[model samples]
Target: MPRHPTFTLRPLHAALCILLAGPAGAQTLPDVVVSANRQEQQSFDAPASIHAVGQDAIEAAGPRVNLSESLNRVPGITVLNRQNYAQDLQLSIRGSGARSPFGIRGARLIVDGIPATMPDGQGQASTISLPSAQRIEVLRGPLAQLYGNSAGGVVQVFTADGPERPELRMSVDAGPDGLSRYGLQAAGQSGAVNYVVDVSDFQTDGWRENSAAERQHLNAKLRWDASEQTRVTVVANVFDQPVSGDPVGLTRGQMEDDPRQAVANATLYHAGKDVAQRQLGLVLDHRLGADASVMARVYAGQRDLDNRLSIPLFVQTAPTASGGVVRLDRQYSGVGLRYSRRLPAGDGQVLFSLGLDHERMGEHRQGYINNLGVQGDLKRDEQDSVHSTGVYAQADWAINEDWSALAGLRANRVAFRVKDAFITGDNPDDSGTASFSATNPVLGITRHLSADTNLYANIGRGFETPTFTELAYRADGSGPNLGLGSASSTHAELGLKTRLTEQQRLDVALFNIASRNEIVVASSSGGRTVYANAGRTRRSGVEVTHSAQWTPEWRSLLALSTLKAQFAEAFTSSGGAVVAAGNRIPGILDRTLFAELAWQPRAWAGFTGALELVHRGSMVVNDLNEDRTDAVTLFNLRLGWQQTVGAWTLRETLRVDNLTDRAYVGSVIVNDGNKRYFEPAPGRQWGLGLTATYRF
Candidate 1:
């Protein structure tokens, strides 16, 4: 579980306002603050690439218990766990932007601000339940061009608002296949109104073999304050899952000799699968005074899925052949709207926004067979639709006191439609169409050489469009190639933020990205696979982070990342040789590393530990490199504890994954030549958890 990176919380809210303004009138650590560039500024004064993850370092890491695998260990991004719990999941951030086979395209997922993907980007998010979240922001390149047709970046989630007392929480967990989990939460306030609620449930018995799973979750929040410039907020969520579709793909020496036999579930296709989701949201924050303020939001969502497969006819010769069945169904809907404003020059601050979105999708299929008993039938239907509108504005100028600058622009208009029907042979029916419009831009710079140090630079541009199974999958008969366009990128970065004293702190970044057209999914004619628009690709990266508090009961954190992707021209297949140009752009993973350590000792006790390392390189499954795979490494561990008596409070955790049961293979798989690959990365697993809280 990874992919969910791009963070920025204004450096942990400037280190919690310098630990709550202590150290006698603290004044450094503040050149500009941020609300994700909607207003409030600083961070090289905004231009893009934001990243933040706090809430006490996400409760001291604890190997992130959900919430998209705790943002998939931050850093550029990559998260693909097609199996091993949480049924079928995938996410990518740089490479694999619009050629998704199943791995949500070009990222863009938000919570609180609503818009949980769904506009052909297809997003379910495993029913997000992060125990009252309070922080998680990641806005990549071009600041994601104000959330519209993302080209890979933007995952914002924020919950747990209005607090100063009243609280309650509970949790429990169990592990090792047959796992179990439960959770509950509550928040409070009265007079001016404020509230929060959450619930969760999870179960698993999977590791292949008819894969079993069960999940349920709900979240809610409300806030109101009629007087003093008015304010209103509301949010809701619901998710459910009941799955059992074991499509095991294994390789890597049979998963290093058995990762539960790499799942296939005793054949017969192993059927049964169901998934559901629902969401609702509303917001209005007014303060028509004090530098002006007005915010509005509306949202709606729904999703349903079903699958069943079974096949078996003449296996090991003909003993009177018999058996076959297939079924699938899917549906989705979405709506959204937004508006924002903020102005007050002088030291700097200016922001603006407008938005609208719509989405719809549907699919159906059926098949049957029973030889010896004689029976056969087949039917299929599909549909897709999407519409979008957007407008944006940004500014943050402070040409004094350490310089600052920022700029923004966004304009989008889109529409796409498709329909299809079939029944056996004789060219049943088909239909398709397409549309597009795009505009994205951004710029940035900041310098505040003192007060703890700061320096920044930025450049931006982004775009993406084309999904709905890449404009109606038709594969073998060609046709359905809607003059592909949209798929562009241009990004640059140079950064540094420091406080290297008083408990240490550091952040560094250097990035580069370039692209053009670049939308691939080859193999046409009879064998299927369409959607093209390739040529050009380049990516460069580096990130470093550090945190400290050596004494006072220890505290530590360290992170490192490096990446390189290439391919800038050269093509000719369809049996024509050629095909070359830097290569190596397949499942990106040059290196990654993470570390953690903690100890509180009093003030409610505390203890934490963690470690992670991964390096994946050497790809090329087909772009005509003739299959390739080699390069792997993995490790993980965690332990945690918390305490507090009186009103009640307790927490505990212990986890060990891989831990030496090594055997990896996770670089986003989807190359059905039948040699089956991708199935490793699960062994020697363990988990145990407990949590409780209360107050009034």
Candidate 2:
């Protein structure tokens, strides 16, 4: 269920510092700090739009849940849980990748210091392990493009590190529709080394038919202080999902007839998937001198996946068609080196950072016919590879106490190659190569208006290349659209950060972006999703956010966004109808609102209560804008209690979601040729979770 938005959410800063000193006669709030720029900086002074959500707020709603559970309220971002586990979640920022059918594309994703997003700008957050998360940082706007080969949004999930004292934690959670989760974590520091490890298992029976899922995950991190000036950190993670079912989208008629029923073909093909991933990363940090430093990070990972779709049987007979069953064996790796130096400049200080980043992904893909729950005749086979390399530099000059400037530039190159191994007489070699390159620059200025306020503005360009999947098909009777080029764009944002009162903080921003060669949906049918370049488009939006600590017992947070995304140039149709200029971009809601309130009265020791409200404006379902999802409002309530006994703490939480039990579509499959666009949201769900922690 969703409702029209009541506009909320906004924040931004520039490099160097945007310090809002604490008020007189009041305990000052600690500076909001971030490390996205390879150095510690104050949020009020950074030139980019960034937001950080801490563990308390993260778990206050639901621990170990999808990002959709916690991120809805954050400005500049949207993550929708389709409830179809096999497809994972759909996430976007500023409507950049809102039309993606599955996973995340067009932006970037990171966990700790490892690249969760590949070099090709494609990513998935299924491996985030919310139970182990200490915080999540989102970086948006033009500066995000400095990360290279992306459309300018960065989502970084950081796992909790070891504490000075040994701690052991265990948790159990259960909810309606047979949902269950069990987790364990251990962390401690000893001498020069610190370590943290977490393991969890999750399972959910479908709210709708053919949508059950089970997953097992493990994550661990170790940090060693090699010397006074050197340190080494290692991060490792493993994920396995033996059963993640796909319910597929439902036609409007089917949704009305029986929203809980699976499409006939989905059940007939045993639509589901199995996934396994393993990753390892190491970071070495060393201080060269008081004015210079170096940091290097290297990572490697692998993924194995098998999936079956609801393709029509007749389509499988086409000679060039890839069958309904898909299998992938992928290996990916990367390394990053960055150097930083600070120099004195007149009355101001200058900070400079230089870096190089490189990554590559190799994939072996195959397709076969689905024989009930088994794999059948071979149909497609190929090897796909992607490599990206970049060099970047940034300089921050604190010209004066009240004024500062930051400038950054980066040059990036990405190459894609594919080799068809299943070439036959009729399905001749469908192999080709494509390369994309771009240079992006960023500039921003911040003015300190007062001890606790600042005004900032920034402008930058963003770039993105098509993924192998998007380039795999050519709708014009050709194979692999290798000639398809990259997309480029320019954006600018003006923002303000200030303290309305000693107890309240607020941030607001207005931004606009215009782009060329924007990727758009061409069609989605017969189990093949294709993409093509739209001539041009523009997106503009406003965001506002406020956090207030009212009375010691009550805390409130509100975030809201309003956006207008439209085509700037008319484009001929891929699905037969011309897409006229000025048409609304499908899948991007016009408005969104997220609000929350928490109460922790002093009289009720160890007790807390929270209420959350999420409202989404109606979203157009396809490029043609012929249909739209109904707007609905959802309410969630949570209550929790903590108790201490003999060096141990016990905690319990209960949450009720979608209290109104409203029937609504959670997301859409944009431009589905079959016109099955809606994916129904679950109604009236409740969960109970319990945790125990021991300290030594």
Candidate 3:
């Protein structure tokens, strides 16, 4: 199950004929609006595989950055930089998600419309804090099936509200390892009330060497208008952090010149890490009388984590170490309702949504003598409770004039409970457990030819359940287990959308997915732990994107994706054929490319210059093909400045990332016998920023 030889698409058709022979300039392009099928269209008439990241590209990408490195310059993303800022931050889209050990377990993270996943879906949303974002949409396969765990897709995030005028902003940044950042923002409007506020602070002394980091943040937004069809909104967020630890599974000459000396014989609780978070929200929007509209929302969140790890043993006479430390507390609550109507047939529309989610998790563990430590006086304690409910309906039929059709369906129900305590030999041991239900489904279609072309198709179903730390994880490490159930998925897609002129725009898709009883995590021989279903799996893909404006100040964007995953049957052990049936699926990557180019000139007054290119391919790090990874390319640069002084406005930016300082390894994790790895980029950096704003 290992093969290589099949490389020639004539350099991807000569890079798409030099990007379709550049320079057809001015074609007016700026309509980009999207809520991705939950309503709000015009992303060239959205049909799926959407992408957006406005707010001026997140202020030219800066300030306590690394939202997967600004989503890896978008385009069939696959960012994996476990450079550890308190570990766990690896992302994947298009190519069947989930690469565990914290951070995304079957993708789904929505903010603003809330649903940051966690109802035993193992949620941890990468400490999001993007300067109170104003946009960030990324929907891929399965068209996300209108949320509710549509298996790998959806990362909607939209913040920043309550401002129609009056504002103040501040930003400061410094880079190159000892990075520092500061930010502040304010907004105002009075009459029917409105306000927004933000604050940030960051510090780093990283790039290795005990790796240090500190963070603090606060965000708030509020709006009210009680008379014209009612409206109310409020949101608050807070975070605090401390981190110091890097060098995970090192080797490559210990990450070239001291990567904290490869954990320095481990200890310090095996490299300590800490985190804290909090959130609160409420939203209501009603206009229940003119064509109909209604919305409601509620949210609450909390999280705390501490970890210590260390392991390195080779007994016979010496060389020893042992580690384990964990402390976690998580709590979340949610409520939602949505309705929209405007139907009399023809130009018809109908939408409905309902949701409820609750979660409470607490776990504690201690067992150390190396691998970092702190969080003691506990041999294990656990408590978990989860509940979920969801309902949905959709329609947007316009069956005429280019035809259109969109249909949807959603259903979900999940429940779980667990309680445990232990302190063996010192007395005390107890347990309790439960599990309830799970279901999902969705569909879509669209067609238009002209007004810039279009065509689409979709099918969906998704689900995941099993948490309480994988049903009480324990493999001689003490206790917790009480049965488990829930894991399913099926997805399909087809697509094409075009604009091709007016500065170009294009999208293309073809997809397939399948899953069943696939829960994984196994090991045996004395220290044993298990949860296996591992049967049935398949994934297929193709994605393409292009954006151009070649003149009128020059602009360009390109994207490509291709994937293939398998394992429909066949599994053996005892050192042979561990996985068969068309192998290939383990951190899937067969090709990915992203390109960006920009130059705004006309006498450089409000200037801009940019260039970016990222490429990745060749991967297969497990399922017993020994292990492999190769193929990497990266480069980035940006320079900016803008102005408008009258109502006050100013901007500045400068960036450069890994211009060339490669020594790859982006992700890997092979249990028990260990085989870590993670660090594919970061080395060669530069940043500078400034911003100011005011209006009205």
Candidate 4:
């Protein structure tokens, strides 16, 4: 196993000291409210680790291309841009989802109160529409368990509501490497209805060989007030990506030789993917009384995908090999209902909530041999389905002036079934079914030390089931690995929230987690991977966040996280490698930092500017720790101008990323048998954006 090294951040320390010593502004920060505990409450009073990113911050970040652009401002989370449009962003929280080769697992995703993650614990971040987002909320630590299975953490996006007056807006953005985006939006409110609609087109030429992509997006929201106590809302969205090139990862040697070159097979086989998706949802809120209410939601969606992989022709000839080409048509839907009531308790009040949710997904899956990018003979066919149901109850009580308590319990059941449709003399029927169930509980307490300080503690249990992708292959090149089991975890956290002055705030949290039967990659080759289990593992970490307003025109924010994650019991991997206890987990960095400074003087009228810094520590690529990537630091800058005349508003922005033009690896593929692990980051890039809005 590789030895963990100490990290130095002298520059960051100096910056912090300077910011802390600066003169304080007179403007006071406003209070924040959150729903992380299934109930509405002040963030400072909630006994959980939760953070919110405002719309202003999001708009100032960059071109609004991906979540990785701004998520770094939050502590205890990691989101990386792989520069491969065919694949989703690589995301993890506290080391839980680092092992995923594609898409997202071990974390939950929600949009407008609708679940974006499927019942099988798989999700894609591409469906989110950042242009229309009002705010984003993130929740981590023990309190996250209340969300049911695979609750390592939660990320939720909320769309903006319509304005009182009718408005139309148009935007254009251009960047290096022939990148461009065009967008249009309309929003308004009538007698009893509110509506918002948005559409966008994005295209980019190759930054590296064989890496180009194009996409179109549409999002809409409508709300109606039936009466004084009844409300209804409808949401619809569409996503289309006609094509996205796949530039496969490179070995260290290949990256050093030429970071801009694609692997030979990528071009030879024309590796890439095509995707389309459509979804619609409805939400209802009714008030039974001033202290009681009921909420219900229903949603349905469909997704179609076609992907081509660069597997050697010889490998596809094996009797049980699935193939090099993949196709999927999936239909999914879900419904949820919740009831809440508030009652007087002691000097304050208690809020009670109970809810039930059910979801299902069915897919037609097919695999075919690839004859130089063309589909050839059929190799496999199957029907797959997953069903999940959960029931939960919670109570938050403000027992007295200085004390509060929260308790919750949840039960979940998930079932998976697959039917074989193509069978041959050499391949026997591989149909199978698997089911998992668990009950989780969480408890928390908070103490108000003074008007400006609060301390809290919490503990909970979490569970996760293997996604169908993980069950598709076995280490020995057999069929689905039904023998794989679920993983469970115990989590605890202690935190502090304090207001240092009228314009500054600080948040700190410490957390620990222990898990059994942790899922891991046994081997990966030719775009396919097999799964196994490690007996036991541990993860502990500390996170710090600070924000300050100095002299009204100067403001700063900083977030830092340090973690220690490792295997706790010795185990022999299916790849014939002996993983010793205490080996550091692969694909997870031990430390990360993000800091920013902004200057927006009142005297400057319409001009604003900011500087940002991001740092990531070294990480191993495999269980044996034979190879790793170097730590890297990046700097970014942005400037903006806004003007209004008559009934029109105009805004423009200039941005630059990776200012130093440093070469580095942004992410890795863990346990890749072919030793193709590193994905190179882009060099210095620049962008320009302009938007115009007209109101009537």
Candidate 5:
């Protein structure tokens, strides 16, 4: 007997942008345009879980340095600021990516319709430029599976278009712990072309011992009307971080004694990382007919990385050891095309979309011994590459006046190849190749309950494959784990969107997911880790969001998420420890809540103020659930003032975080073999910012 999968998903932009615009006593929420279904559609009518963070929310009294600063407000999404910039933030959706060792996996990241995530299903958010961003959209649940491999969710960032009139803006921000940022932006329209350019530099000096970092970013965009029915856009960006110190994690006792202290080995090894990246892309859109259109995009990028780890000196002596210092020069590129058409139906119309995506990444990887802060003799070298291709088709039908249906299918294939360059006496040719493929399908339906209420449900399949890093070693230290299998999942979701009153809106969703051959760490020793397939795992969650405009000057928002993620079958972990069937997944909180109250007065010179509260439940550090972080609650406050005179505009902002000065763990390292798992959150901190703009 085949078991049917069942689940529920939430709404689109449910709690954001409700009061960003509109008059003092507006009765209806503003309409938002989203690309959740690979087309521009009203979010209120979309049958998926999606949210958009606008420019106002992203730039509100914040440094605009990290995505974690603004993503916390979205329900069912978690952005853990490690504070150690060398490792990047840890992001997860509904517990899907909780097991990541570092960086991002189990999700797809897109910037300007170009994939930020590599074909191997790994990504870093450090390259994003927030200063010139217009909006960020997050999509979750079954519909997200249409994006292909590791599509536990999808996050996309879009750059703002140029202004109608020429303008120049400069901003400066300063804070405690030697934190500072300087930014410049220029935007204007000239003839048939519109352009926007931004540059920024940020630095921080030791928020914790041995944790200093500096970075610079440059972003540019240009758009033009190529023909009467065609438009073209070009985007380019660069990111450079010469160095960022890695403090690593601390033990429970070490955190209790002093939360700001770095691990002893981290200082001894001088752990750190250096990164540089540049990318360019082009997009073209053309109208084929009154009810038909076509879009195409091409992008390419290169990244250079040098990372130093805290592995002991003796660990490098082993024949199979890959050394403590790592270097990588990587090149990635992709191309995409989509065509959409509308056909007449009995009562409404059927919208059809067809698309194709192809991407590839190649890397020159090397390893060297870390002799203190310097690199020693080479220990390993290899050339690795991955290629991914996907084809999909979708249809949306307005079955009747009160009902709608959506269906989509996608086929994907990923191939990985490695060639060994360091074939020493003891290390034979460790090169290997592997390939994985999957076909995913999704179906959704929407029922109109009333003029102000909608009910939706969807179901789909998802797939994930092991990355080059995960397959780098075998549990027995033989060679690459080419036998490791991929993971597949079934997802289902149900949701409700309703307006409780003229000024209040509510969104609720429930979802369930089950996976087979789930990936897990089989063992970890020295600087190497091996992975294996677990029997089964399950994740179930509920999300709710409420937004209300009490008056013209008062607004409130609330977002809540609760998830239960666990192993569905018993499994053995590192050191032969049996993980019980019901053990909670490591590094994922069971519950989280965010609430905010904002105020603005027309008579106070454009003054605005807001108070925010955040709460998180305790999370286990390892698969055994033997150790956990403490639950915590935090408060934040922000105030802003703006004044305009003639052609000049000036704005000032003040922000305070962790207002109660509570000490807590911000994040945890899952399944760390050495028992160093805790990353402590900072105490009370404040920042001030000033901006000036001129119109010509």
Candidate 6:
């Protein structure tokens, strides 16, 4: 076994001292984020771990094409790019949603006040509209529990507001591995209406064989001021992924031979997926009185998907076998309303918000036999539906100039129902209904120290329900598992926020979480998926992030995280294999550091350059704690230039990633029973793009 490295911050402390010696001058701080409290307030006043990535950071290297570019710099968060379009990125916060096989779970995703996470705690970012996003806010610790179910943490994306003047922008990008993208956007305001529209198309021959993908996106947002007391906003978007190839995971032997090689089954069965989705949302804000208001939103969407798996032919011919071809047609809708009331008190004021949310999802699920690339006999059919509702009350009170408090309570209930549509010839009735509910609460306190420093602590209870995919099958040959219970946990945090200098700021935090009845993947065979409740987990960690403008033309940023997550009790796998306590959790790195430096010399106007370094520690691959991937470090370089002339502006950038051409595992499929666990990342790649804009 390899020796673990000792924990120390001496290296970072020394670096901070050097940065503090820069030219002393007055500079304004960036805009404070208010999403954490669901209201507009200075970040320093919030008693939580909150961070924001603004428009300048999002477009530093040009157009925002990938979410990882912004997320990897945030503390207490992990966003891994699998480079496989068939699967969404693996995202987790403080060991929350690491075990998910596909899509995002255990976290709330919000876009323009609309819930991207479905009623059953399943989510995907296929329609994020990154190119048109103005900012993203991440909320961690107790404050996140206010979102109800699946509240591991909160990630919210806000659309860019239209400019007062009409403007149009066009851009084209190209990179290695047959990567190409085109984008166009138009924004402006006309009298009482403000509008922004963006469209993009992308295609790539991926880093690995049989991993190519093609996609297109269209997004629009509009707001109208009907009167001084009432306003309405609309948001709509569509995503179409006509081609997304799956390369599948590689075994140890296969990776050793060639890291770029595709799994044999992937090419044999032509495994891949096709998806199309469209959604629309509307929001209204009305003032009832001087100290009261109402905000409400309604949204609806539809999604169609068909995927082909790589199951062996023999497995599908068995009598009690499920098929390898899956199809889903789903329709979903939701409504949310909130009432805000404020009252003046002694030397302070109190703000309270009462909210209600309701959502429903209906899906037509079918399975078919796979004969190479052709579909064969039917295997399973069912109508699956989920209905959920939540009621919540949140408040923020400022007792005086030196103290403040925030508290919230939420009650959530979700019902899952399945209607068996294929019950012929030995296929016994497989219909059932199950419900799960939880009551979550959060409390936080903030102590204002000096003028520019604060200390805070918070604690909360959170819960999560199984996704529809987790309840599709049972291991005891009894069809669907309807008795699965919800998972619950408690989270605690202590943090310090301070402004060290006019141009620098720092945040440090410590957190712990203990969970019970955690759900884990049990077993999978013949395309049937099953899950079971397992051992408890204890996770503790420390996170820090620092940002500074070292000099007039130089800037630096740093983020570091150290985490220890392990099982708290001995358990057994679904295959009857014993798993001991103290096993490190799979799918997360124990430690990570990200550092960046940028130089924009005044000598050369309109020119900027940056260098980034990233490091990730080794991580276990499965429950046995017998296999792990090696640690890896990478370097990236970026350069850009901007100029404005009369009525036109031009910008261009070049980016080089993985400059060392390192070979590493990007992510792991948690607890794969077949022992296939490794997913190799791209070696090296580069991209260059230019944007031209017109103002009228």
Candidates in order have lDDT scores of: 0.60, 0.85, 0.66, 0.87, 0.86, 0.84
- Model 3 alpha-carbon miss at residue 418, Å: 5.5
lDDT of 2 by residue, 202-283 (tens): 9999788999999999999999999999999999999999998888888989988888888888898899889999999999
Predicted model with the maximum lDDT:
4
lDDT of 1 by residue, 29-125 (tens): 3232345665444543444556667655564443234544555556666665655343355666645452344436787877877767766555545
Superior by TM-score: candidate 1 or candidate 4: 4
User: Would you estimate the TM-scores of all the predictions?
Assistant: 0.32, 0.96, 0.33, 0.97, 0.95, 0.97
lDDT by residue for model 6 over 1-696, one digit each (tens)? Answer: 123354355786787667656555645456476668777777766788888888767876433666777787888888787777887788888878888766888888999999999999988876688888898888889889889889899999998988999899898888888988899999999999999999999889988888899989998999999999999999998999999888887777777778788888888887888899999999999999899999999999999998888889897666656677889999999999999999887889999999999999999988888889689998888899999999999988888989888889999999999998878666777899999988999998889897789999999999999989788777765357887778999999999998888788888999999999987777643224578888698899999988888677888888888889888898998888887889988887898888899899999899999999887777787777878887777898999989999878898889888898887888877777666677788877788988888998
Off by over 4 Å in 2: 1-30, 476-479
* Candidate 1 structure lDDT: 0.60
Candidate 4 all-Cα RMSD: 2.0
Instruction: List the candidate numbers ranked by lDDT, top first.
Output: 4, 5, 2, 6, 3, 1
The candidate, 5 or 6, that scores higher on TM-score is 6
User: Cα lDDT for residue 379, model 3?
Assistant: 46
Taking all chains together, the TM-score of candidate 2 against the true structure is: 0.96
Quote model 5's TM-score: 0.95
Tens-place lDDT digits, model 5, residues 493-604: 9999887777777788899999999988665433356788888999999998877777777788888888999999998875788999999988898888888999997678
Off by over 4 Å in 4: 1-18
In terms of TM-score, the best-performing candidate is 4
- Per-model root-mean-square deviation over C-alphas: 24.2, 3.8, 25.3, 2.0, 5.1, 2.1
Rank all candidate structures by their TM-score, best first, as comma-separated numbers.
4, 6, 2, 5, 3, 1
Candidate 4: the clashing residue pairs are: none
Cα deviation of 579 in candidate 6 (Å)?
1.7
Tell me the TM-score of model 3. 0.33
